[model samples]
Target: DQQVKQNSPSLSVQEGRISILNCDYTNSMFDYFLWYKKYPAEGPTFLISISSIKDKNEDGRFTVFLNKSAKHLSLHIVPSQPGDSAVYFCAAPFLTGNQFYFGTGTSLTVIP
Candidate 1:
């Protein structure tokens, strides 16, 4: 019943190391990829995004990589920090429908 899902439900990374979060979607026509970070008692915040045409998008320490042919999405965080510890979700809205697919959140723990 889920179109987008994270490879793992959780991840742990040492501080200052690169943390790679992976997501896969079943929809082949997905045009946009979105990464959101959420903390306790708060709504998901948009962290970064990329269009299907672009293979990669970077913003500061966060980078999103998209592989259309593989229907894969990845969020890379360089120099992971404790403050970066949170639940991350990958989402994409159907280009022609009202449905939006969201990945089962991946809880990331950036160990200090």
Candidate 2:
């Protein structure tokens, strides 16, 4: 079972435009970043969430940035595509650093 459910809220972006998704954290113990993307008929898979120590990480058209001082995280998708349409989730690890606390996801729709 998925750890979190997607909220009714959603985001719609035009294809080939920049799509920015943001997340914020209040816990200082959050050392590592965790983001997941879920597609229809598939389980949520790890996307990109670099460690808090690192400011940014990128994979192809997707980029993730972490701001430790501000306790904020952002994922940037350049040239967004229809294939990128999915539910994106943000997660933080527990104090014990064993399990993770997942946030209600944000549904993203890419307008082709």
Candidate 3:
């Protein structure tokens, strides 16, 4: 099964706090990992990504950690903001240019 699981359907945090989003995958062949942020009807924007060769990737307030052995990954948002209040999706691609499989998505709310 091409199941990438996001256990939590929602999360809430205060501004300037840390927001953690978790994801897991069942397929061992997935080599590239990506995190996207979605707001309502718009498409998800690429937030950060890591390859099978790397264990972690960071970009400004966002960071993604991969544990190949556990088939798991997580996204951490430092100093979470109201702008960060949106749905996040974790996707894995089988190969370059291939369609990606998505998790159910995590809706995050950041209070002022």
Q: Write the per-residue lDDT of candidate 2 for residues 55-84, one digit (tens) a residue.
A: 999999989998888777888999899999
Instruction: For residues 3-106, write the lDDT of model 1, one tens digit per residue.
Output: 99897999999999999999999989889889999999999999999999899999999999999988898999998999999999999989664877899999
TM-score of 1: 0.96
User: What lDDT does model 2 reach?
Assistant: 0.83
> What is the Cα-based lDDT of residue 46 in candidate 1?
96
Local accuracy by lDDT, each model? 0.94, 0.83, 0.94
| Model 3 C-alpha lDDT per residue in residues 1-112, reported as the tens digit of each score | 6479999999999999999999999999899889999999898898999998999999999999999999999999998999999999999987564678999999999999
Off by over 4 Å in 2: 1-8
Best by TM-score: 1
Q: What is the TM-score of each candidate against the true structure?
A: 0.96, 0.87, 0.94
Instruction: Please identify which of the two predictions, 2 or 3, would achieve the higher lDDT against the true structure.
Output: 3
| Stretch of 10 with least lDDT, candidate 1 | 93-102
Model 3 gets an lDDT of: 0.94
